[model samples]
Target chain A: MKELIEKYREIGFKLTPQRLAILRFLKGNTSHPTAENIYRQIKEVYPTVSFATVYNTLQALVDRGEVTEVTIDSQKRHFDPYPKPHHHIICIECNKIGDVFKDYSDALKLPKNILKEFKPVRNHINFYGICRECQKIGGIKYGNMSKSRAGCREF
Target chain B: MKELIEKYREIGFKLTPQRLAILRFLKGNTSHPTAENIYRQIKEVYPTVSFATVYNTLQALVDRGEVTEVTIDSQKRHFDPYPKPHHHIICIECNKIGDVFKDYSDALKLPKNILKEFKPVRNHINFYGICRECQKIGGIKYGNMSKSRAGCREF
Candidate 1:
């Protein structure tokens, strides 16, 4: 964690208390929290942290390629700290996001016309699924695993 | 256009003036307008079109699956009226979106663990690229293809 702080300093990032707090919260976070969520979490410790500060720190981190933004939710943008190439599977029932660490580039071949027109840079896949909690709820509500599993389109 | 009204009506959708105007504008729209963008367009014709009406029509269309809500734009939700199964490639420079009719399900197969934990339903792929207009702008602004491509990575 201290090494990360040194890295931000080397990158000319100002080590403001608010920014440090934001960085600490995001360093190993997998929850993919929105800016509002980050602001709320940071406020618990640093009561004086402003929303603008949080946004600024996030912008800085994004610019540095240390974080990625997840737009799976329609309402607000969520931030991911991992710089690794991966995909996300979001539970349609709970809106919880889980990371899938695998490269599917082999499968994402662009169409001929698309390659002709615009040079494709990168691709993102969004998978919709039901989590364990939703599955448990299904068992209680529907009284059977077979019917609930049947309700889900593909096995 | 009459067919659209009757089709939505068959689904028990209320055809208010704003809803009808929105339906008319969106009947053949492929530009994928967001709710706010739709409200701005509708307000031009009917000054009384409230935000609520825009949201209500959007939610109604989404519920009926007449309009596909796209999350390509991280800032806001974009709507697609083309019920045909397709994907989108967004121009990172100009935010213009292009359609890709080909399916990449084979390439996007979820990992065994993800498939086991959550029942998979559907998937959407968003590809980032530079549009022709943006390509032209890129040529004028940067004078190098690599530099112009770097601009897209600014996000």
Candidate 2:
């Protein structure tokens, strides 16, 4: 935590108390919290904290490569602190996200045709399935997968 | 078009005029338009059309496996009518999405560790980069990459 504070300070990221709290919350966060989630958590400590502060801090952090924005969830953006290339697996039932550490760089060879049209910068794979608790709760209705998976209509 | 009409009708999908208009708009659409985009186009022909009608028709079509909701865009859902196992490449500048017809299923083998926890259902890969027009327009600002690629902090 001290390292992060010093690093941000060196890079001109103003360590406002609320931003500090947000940075603290996101430092090693793995739950992939949304901006509102971060705001709510920060609001508990600083009752007067504004959403703009939370959003601004997030944007600044994103700008400085301090945080990663996970876009698997369509409704809202989720934030991750780890600044490495990785994949994500989301629970179709509860929207819980888990990190996938496997490097599929070799496996994800784009077809010759696509490479011709798109100068592929990078790729992120979204794996969809059910989570353990949701499976136990019997909430995996056949037609009720989360909206994100609504895109995978071919399946 | 007649085949699609008969196909949906045979599967018990109601063929209201608005729904038909939506179906016609989406029948072979590759543009990956959002619901609002679709609604605006439909409203040009049927000015009295409501957003609820467009959303409801989308939901119904998704339920019936007639339309696929593409979730690469975090702000709004885009729809694809061709319900085949395909992928997409999106321009980070103008949000232009193109179809990728290559099959990568055989190559997407999950690691042994991830395979044990979650039942792998399906996979969608989003390829991000600048398009020809965006490149010609010189819109690739240092911080202008879309939020999805915001995960790739190094870029």
Candidate 3:
């Protein structure tokens, strides 16, 4: 956290109180929250904080390689704050995202055909799954957003 | 094309003039255009096609598994009309999307650890690269909208 604060100061990213709150929330956050999610959480303390501030801070983090924008969900974009490259699996029953930090770059070698046009770079894997809670709930629905995950533990 | 028309018609689709126009445009289109792109193309001909109609058709196609929505780009959703599951390579320099029709489901198998909390269902891979056009055009200045591919041609 201290290192990040220093880096943010060095980058001249005027770290406002709202930005500090955002940074603290994102410090070790593994929830892979959308912009609205972050804004809502921060609004509790920083009542004046807007989505614009959350988004701007996220954008700056992304530009600094301290965050990643995940596009798996169609409704909104999720932000992954972990700088280290990793894979994710989202519960099809809930919008819950779990990390799979293993490196699969070697196993992801492109097929002989695709090499003709593209010089393949890095890759990300989004595995769809049913979490333990959703599995216990017993429903045919996949990706249920209404279920509050309060107290639901993260892996 | 005739086969697809008959197939869709037999499946209870209305096959309206506008739907046919969209269908014909997307039949073998590898361009991976968004709904707005489809609307723009159809508007050039139909001129009266509404955005809602285009989105509705896209939603219907998605529901019927006639198209796969590509979320590799963060800015706008790109719809691919192909039914077959395949990977995609996007040029970092020009944003051109190329198809990779290889099956990597075997290699993409999740770790036994992740299997504890979530059930793995499907996987998709996105490879980033530099296309021929972007290489010649110097390069597209990177931006959040850098993924909107244009000027894609066969090498």
- Which of candidates 1 and 3 is the stronger one according to TM-score? 3
Which of candidates 2 and 3 is the stronger one according to DockQ? Answer: 3
User: lDDT per residue, candidate 2, B1-155, as tens digits?
Assistant: 79978998999888889988998888767677778888999998899999999999998888777787787766777778787878888776656677788778788887777777677778888888666655666744655454443323211
lDDT by residue for model 1 over B99-122, one digit each (tens)?
888887766778888877878777
RMSD of each: 6.1, 5.7, 3.4
**Residue B2, model 2: Cα distance from true site in angstroms:** 2.9
What local lDDT does model 3 show for residue B30?
76
Best by lDDT: 3
What are the lDDT figures for the candidates, one per model? 0.78, 0.76, 0.79
Query: Model 1 reaches what TM-score against the true structure?
Result: 0.84
The pairs that clash in candidate 3 are A92-A143
Best first by lDDT, ranked: 3, 1, 2
Per-prediction TM-score of chain B?
Answer: 0.81, 0.84, 0.83
> For residues B8-124, what per-residue lDDT tens digits would candidate 3 score against the true structure?
998788898899999999987877888888999999989989999999899888878898888776667899987788888887666678888888787777888889988787888
Q: Could you tell me the C-alpha RMSD of candidate 1 in Å?
A: 6.1
Candidate 1 is graded, for docking, as: medium
lDDT, candidate 1, equals 0.78
- Expressed as tens digits, the lDDT of each residue in A13-83 for candidate 3 is 88788998999998888778888889999999989888888888898888877888886877677888887
DockQ of candidate 3 is: 0.63
Candidate 3 CAPRI-style tier: medium
